[model samples]
Target chain A: MAKHSFSLSPLSSFILPRGDTLFYLIALFSILSLLIHHLSPVSAESRHFEGFDADEIDDFGDSDEPISAAKHIPPPPPTTTLSVSDPIESHHGPPPPSADPTSQVTSQPSDPKPASTSFEVWDEDEFEGIPQSPPSDSPLITESDTAASAESDPSLKLEPESEPESPKSISSYTVEIVCVSFLIMFVINYFTGKKENEKLALAWASKFATKDSIFDKNFSLLGVGETDDSPLLLKEGQNVFKFYASGRRFCQGLLATMELKSRHDLISRLYNMVVPCKDEITFEVYMNDDAMDHVVVAVAKKKLAKTMQKETTDLQRFASLVSPPSGKKWIAEELAVVAESKEVAGDMLNETVLDQVFGDKAYEKFGKGFISMHFSDQHLGSHKKMLVFKFALPDAKNMADMTRLVALVPYYIDLIGRYKLSSHARTKTDGARMKVAQEIYKELQNARQEALQRKKAEQRKKGEEAEAKLSAEALRKKEAKERARQMKKAMPKMKMTRTG
Target chain B: MSSPANDPRQPSTAKPYKPSPVAPQDLPIDYSGFIAVICGVFGAMFRYKICSWLAIIFSAQSLANMRNMENDLKQISMAMMFGIMGLMTNYLGVGPRGSKKT
Candidate 1:
């Protein structure tokens, strides 16, 4: 006997290690750069007002004041007093302007400037007493004096410029903080959510598909190159697992897939919370063509039965809603049936099955978890005949409780494979299928005929278009040739030379 | 019950069933992976940061959950490439309005 080795090396081999590592490194670099860009001092300072610089302000003051000073009074005395007072006031009164500059500037800009000489005289007196006053008292008097001076003097504009910039810088700082926090939150959610989804899938597989389990007993868990101990439930994708069953009598094989919700994605998780959905396990068994008689039957939850009938191709073509026999309810009140005829429904939902479904233990407790089951020998796809069962998966802890439901798969496979439709019911289904086949045939014939006619018409139109494009002489010659041919055909048959 | 060798009525051979391999044409199409690629391209062309991010996430989801490696790899790779391109262009490229204000 060949040795059986079981490992997840095959699964890991599919991952591109270098690609993933490079991708993560690039992502990390981009994120770090984004954070640095936002929090950097250069970006913070850019938010400040850029309209005017101190030199420009000084240039404006120097250029404008001399014109006024030259016109109003002798420039030398005021220049000397202004130069001497400017430095002292700036040093002594800078704190006052910084503290309450906005209010004073707003008030001072409104006040009328009576005389430039008066402002100069007041500045000189204020500078002389500046050192004697306390620091706190100086700001109030200094602000008022500056505001008054600013109205007469242009150089004082620099103090108010810094005021507006403070508010802008603070607002930008708050925005940067918000962006950094959001990036961190997104990264954290992504990794944690991914781990949570993987754990859920692993837990479900461990609980239901161990060695010597029902699945292992019935199905061939080992694939072509896999070992005896290889995991029975193959993880095909993040939320999907597949188990293959072969060596069955009637069906080719059963492909069972467990499809879980997208819990790893934060947005999808939130959406699922708002609109509830379930994780489902689906079993698709393709039966051999001759294994079953002509039949299409589906049993589903009452709410989904209508939709199943509408959407499924075979159900839409051959089956209709089958109400329960005379007085008794369906297999369960919650269940609905759609079948080709009442006879097949009876055969499918017989007394034993009905009793088990209605019994207190299995279906009654986990009834809602039963989604739908469909059987059709006339299915439309590549595998024409199939049996499909879909059930909502319960949580990992309660996985064992659904054993009864899972057992139904093998039981139904055998039962349905051996089932033979009565002669009368078989004829009715055959007639219905024959009628549909004829309808499809007629539709195909009509389409082919239409295409042929369209092609011929297109050829004729192209010939006429070519004729229209000819020169006048060519048109005349073509018409004459047509006339001659008609004349030759129209001429009477002559046998006068052989009359003798 | 009569012995089968003596009776000569029952069939002698019994063959175990082995299922035929699934054909490539029968595999289900990966619709989510296709959608991810489309979103990725639109994100890159339009410079929509949100769309770019969504494309990256969707690509990862598709890649992690793929069923058939041969069938799904091309689509997953295309989606991932476009997603990365979109992110790089939207973040590292100059603003859609031109250079940033000095």
Candidate 2:
């Protein structure tokens, strides 16, 4: 390798050693000077050649070393081993899907290279403009060892070797420059771009409403919810809303819709999905950095569908019930309530009657206009098992949170379910079942309420009965004594009258 | 090829040719100088960490009285400020051989 580095070494070897050393010293100082030049600083530094001193310059000049140390380097992308990797499905430069453990797809990794550095065999005819081979099988110069004479120039023809020193560098200045440039360019290309979370947020917003493709010729989004069987609807008059045109939320039109079953379900899903703390939190917790944020869009879709179905039915009922029949409107209204609530029972398992009937309107009114919409506060006897509707006063912010403080909605809904079980404890309406539910609620409230007082009054009734029994016994004894005294007085009066 | 012999053993027949100064040539330089040059180049980079670490240790009074000083220079921010100061000191003004600041 050392013999092969230089072409001029042999021609210069015949010169006097003393004179040769002078030329060598010039080369050495040239390299040391370049070294000092290289260390000054990278970018906008103020100093220039300030690190150089007299002794350093003299020391560099004294050495008889070569100035031809600049090595040859390959072009930009020093060794661009490009192999067209399989073009996997990409959504605008697909995420380096490796980071997302839940995601299945992967970014096409660059072509793999053998993880070793060793001698590479090149084809004999591969060197383009090189020399001819010598007589005794000079083609296969397997190793670096070369002892050919002046008549032969091995590969590139003209050069004969001289130095018997180790090859410290590749010694090709052009190649070195090209390789360094390539490496620097590669490093620069690795860094300027959008963060991963931003891209995910945009993609998620796009896929929020419809299950559609981001980019592809071969694509289809299959609808999963609407099938042969539909879930039970549990609300009478819920308006449906949908998000469309990616990131643009407007109430301009009705495109798709459904009604929610248990309001508790919405709150439950929210609690389950969002990391819960002292209080239930919203999506704004992560804010812009919400990459793992999966929007609970399926719940919204179902609620909207329910709303559309109810509105169409209501329109028909309103027209029919308007004829001569007076009670017809009331009947139609009742049927709508039942049908809407039945929608809930159709889907949910271990179905509770209280949630199906009043879950939709539990937090509805301030207990005005529609009192039966919630059963948690009222005694079961007066309200009975039925679905009710509130006028949806003041237009609650979303489908559920105005009158419905989302935090309080579920507990009230759960209480209604418990209230139903306690109210139905008895087959007959002996008031015991209702009475028990009232007792439980009073216990839950820990307040001296009317319902609690009523139970206390019932308890006092038993005590009064026991007291009355004791008083009756005492009164009988007093009456007997009075009768005996009267009899004695009457007998005395009769005797005295006879004597007279 | 046109040079005459300088010896006068037989007959001094020709003019002696002065040997052209042996052509100024190059020699191989080792990798040690390149290594030294890179070390010197990067030695300036380590000062940032040193100054920042030292600021945390020495100037604790300013750090302790951070809340009272409303000028936004405190432990955390001051450490970062010191780093920038060190880097600027290295870049612009020459001080001691390895001084963080001039």
Backbone clashes in each candidate structure, one number apiece? Answer: 1, 25
The superposed Cα distance between candidate 2 and the true structure at residue A118, in angstroms, equals 55
Would you estimate the TM-scores of all the predictions?
0.63, 0.17
lDDT of 2 at A112: 27
Model 2 DockQ vs. reference: 0.01
Estimate the overall C-alpha local distance difference test score of candidate 2: 0.29
- Over the stretch A172-220, how does candidate 1's per-residue lDDT look in tens digits? 4553355446445645766776566556555655655556565555554
DockQ top scorer: 1
* Model 2: CA > 4 A from native: A1-193, A209-500, B1-80, B90-95, B98-102
What 10-residue stretch in candidate 1 chain A is worst by lDDT?
A132-141
The native-contact fraction of candidate 1 is 0.07
* Model 1: how far residue A141 lies from native, Å: 31
